[model samples]
Target: MYKIAPRISQLTVRQVEQFRSASAWVNPSRSRTESGPEASIDAEKLFINPEVQQLLVELTGMDLEGKVFRARRTTMQQRSHFALMTDERLSETMDKMRREAQRFLSFIPLKEPRSEEVTILSKDDDIKAFDNSKFVFTDITFDATDQDRTVVVREVDGTLRTATPEEHDRMNRVYYEKPNRPVFPPPVFKDPYLQDALARKEHEFVLDWACWFYEPDDPAYVNLVQCVCDRTVDNNDFEVLHSTRHFATLVFYLALNGNIPPLLNYFGGQGRIRDCANLVRLQKRLLPNWRFAISTSDTDLKIVTDFVKQNSRFHEALKDLIAFLKDGVILSRASPKVGSSFSAKAVPKVHISSLLISAFYS
Candidate 1:
């Protein structure tokens, strides 16, 4: 009873190229300063991002915004314990701290399924003869399933550990051949080949291959999807991710990392007001303090309007969303049905947000 995991690429509907770059894209404000390569990498001002501020403001409430001053009665108390920092310097320091915190949060990993146990085969004294190439061994017993098979690797430095999920997949492919699954990962997963594939708008293809070839938690797979998903978001290639599963993956990654506002804007620009509403709802559910159980009877418009009423900062970053809703109301003289065809049910109800929050500590 062998079953193959469906390729995300083959399952996806290739999007028709639309001239979306010409459209004014309303996105979270980012400050960019001319410096060097590092500056470009750190250009995103996460502290100023409305979504980040929204979550922080909710969680901290008045503490984040309130300032406390101590009244000094004694002369000793009145004497400053330390030199006072100027407002400009204090602001810069706060921004630096926030950036560091944001960077740390983004790198945090989510919960992954259990990995195979590793068995050590070599010892310190016996490993000196080996070269740099690590040897990976796989158990191919008739009773062993590809997933449950034992795969171990002996490092060149004499450390023996379980094969990484990527290595295990490669070993499995080597022992039990599967069409399109290569023993060695395709060069397309790397450098110029990846760039070329992205340029040709083969994002789905790349994503499918990456998922098929590597475990979902594999670093390479994660990096590849981030690149592909970011490009798809930037280019407004929404049609390229037609599969509900693939779309859910995109949403999970973006919402997990707090980088989903731009995707909402894309939906708004495409006149997908329903989508914008659902996305906002999804974002709210991902926040620790905001995960109140949503009523199944709540309409999309109600969900969005409730959020808009409470969140003043979204007026700017979600300008497209606001305008889209307004236009639909005026034109249709009815509740907008845009993007309703793609139901929120497309997203899995597996407590993905909970997993993300737990992963922050793990």
Candidate 2:
């Protein structure tokens, strides 16, 4: 039924011991209120975006353009804000979204049915993976409506059943009782059924993470957060606590206010251009059509583009070769003659952001 038992836990006994001794491992950037420091990825400052201005006009027929943050709140204020985007039609505040998400989580149908509209949450995967005691998991809800449309999942041969009143109480504790919840740190299977049920559905509609999630207790919490992240075989990887928060942030923005944009599609943490060549082959196996992309940072961009551009020249038969991410980005492709097809083209990242805005507003 399985190739091997997945590592019992992402943390070995040694890793947990390391955290117990350290008073506090400082994040180099400082500004660590919680959830580690804020993400300093790319040109994320989109306050003065011309594209966003244009988008507001085209969609709302109003001059409602400027920094996306509320007029009352400052940019720094918005940095820690989880529900960063809003509209009257969608959630208007972080608390509102959290309530909606918690309500959704609390929903357990009276009768479970097996239909695409309903997902049987995977129930046999690693246990205790998502039992973190910080940050509410209520991030974003896709095309969410003012309805109580809840969801659940099950094992291959399991039956879906309704949650009793007591069961609901227990589930709430698991989902919301963060500070009070204790991680026994061992063979104790505190909540096996709950963890499996939360394993991302086979074709789950949304993959979200609590931007404010940071467990102060687990000293080595950062790595533990990454370990608990769901890596679905269906390609719905929720890699929060690291290099992929941008994807979730984008979803929060677009789906709530404007048309949902195509995801920037992370091809997993290929280690910041450490494996540019191998990335091409892996991406080919995963996603072939969405070939163009921006990597974690400019250093990553260089590693990938530099290799591909040089490889193109070695062919001798192929000349006038151009790399795709020269402007600072990384990409992978499969070419018959090139062996590992990769490219880079100088693009004003503003243009990349602009184009992404265009696609969504369109």
Candidate 3:
């Protein structure tokens, strides 16, 4: 008999919420079913799994998991103004973009000026109006009471309109009420995890903003590169580097944020020769087809040679460098394609020095 391994399934945050809602409906005992003292008593006995509890706390912004319940509220307002030098050129460009958008919208005949509504069974029903158009549609209520479900639509300005009933009754079923998730009032940062995630997102946003504002070869690009280098150096985890999938992902993110230089610098840096050699050895073992540049620069070679001559203990470094150079030469000859194919198959078994050598060659 063959043994079957349990498969891991990943769920999206929204799906997880739906799962929780469904769980509440399915397992009535897990939720408060009654009113008054009985509900409170039942709630005390209903134990939530730690993971679900954490997710609920995150989603609701109420720390009601376990004994640590912290209520937090936050509100944000942003305002900015730019004073132009009364230049007609800038104004003209702005007007042109607006007019272009308007003209593009005019091609779509969906803009019914009269206050009216049109119920749509599915997105396909609105396909005719998909062309650029400025129209307001609102007051959508899904009617779940009827066997032939339908969406009741009303214009925001109060005109009512009805559409043909949908054949699918499931479409009208209310999956769950949108939770009135607690909104932090003002001047408050949420949980540390949330704060960290938000900060990271903001940093990425700023990097994108800068990239769009400046040319690719701008000095800002160099700064961005340096910043990534700093982060790589600071958070140099050898274990993560050893995993090709993990390392590639990290590199991809850094590259996407326009910070590849730091990664290059870290790989080529003289300080981590042993680590680099190990990395190179590992890469060669895992991805034999992939070629990496090992620094054969006179300055680096001479430095290695001098260090070996002065310190007997550093002879290992010389050996690693040689191995790295050998791998680089092989890769160069092979011209192994860059990216994942090279990473996954080539068993990474080289020493840190090999990585350094590969970086130099690169």
Q: State each model's CA lDDT, in order.
A: 0.50, 0.28, 0.30
Off by over 4 Å in 1: 1-127, 130-133, 156-158, 291-299, 309-312, 328-362
Better candidate number, 2 or 3, judged by TM-score:
2
Residue-wise C-alpha lDDT for candidate 3, range 165-184, written one tens digit per residue: 22111122233222321221
Best by lDDT: 1
TM-score of each candidate structure, all chains considered together? 0.52, 0.21, 0.19
Candidates 1 and 2 compared by TM-score, better number: 1
> Local error of candidate 3 at 259, Å?
11
Q: How close is candidate 2 to the true structure, as a TM-score?
A: 0.21
Q: Model 3 off-target regions past 4 Å?
A: 1-270, 291-362
As a whole number from 0 to 100, the lDDT of residue 323 in candidate 2 is: 20
Give lDDT tens digits, candidate 2, residues 1-362: 12211221222334323333221222223221123322331112231234432322222211111211214323464444334444763545545644444333321111111111222222444543443332111212564221211222232344232232223223444444555343223221123532442342211211222112222222233332222332221222322211222222222222222111112123212122233333332222222232334354545434344333433323221121212221333343332121343454343332233332232223
Task: Compare the candidates by TM-score and give the number of the best one.
Answer: 1
Rank by lDDT (best first): 1, 3, 2
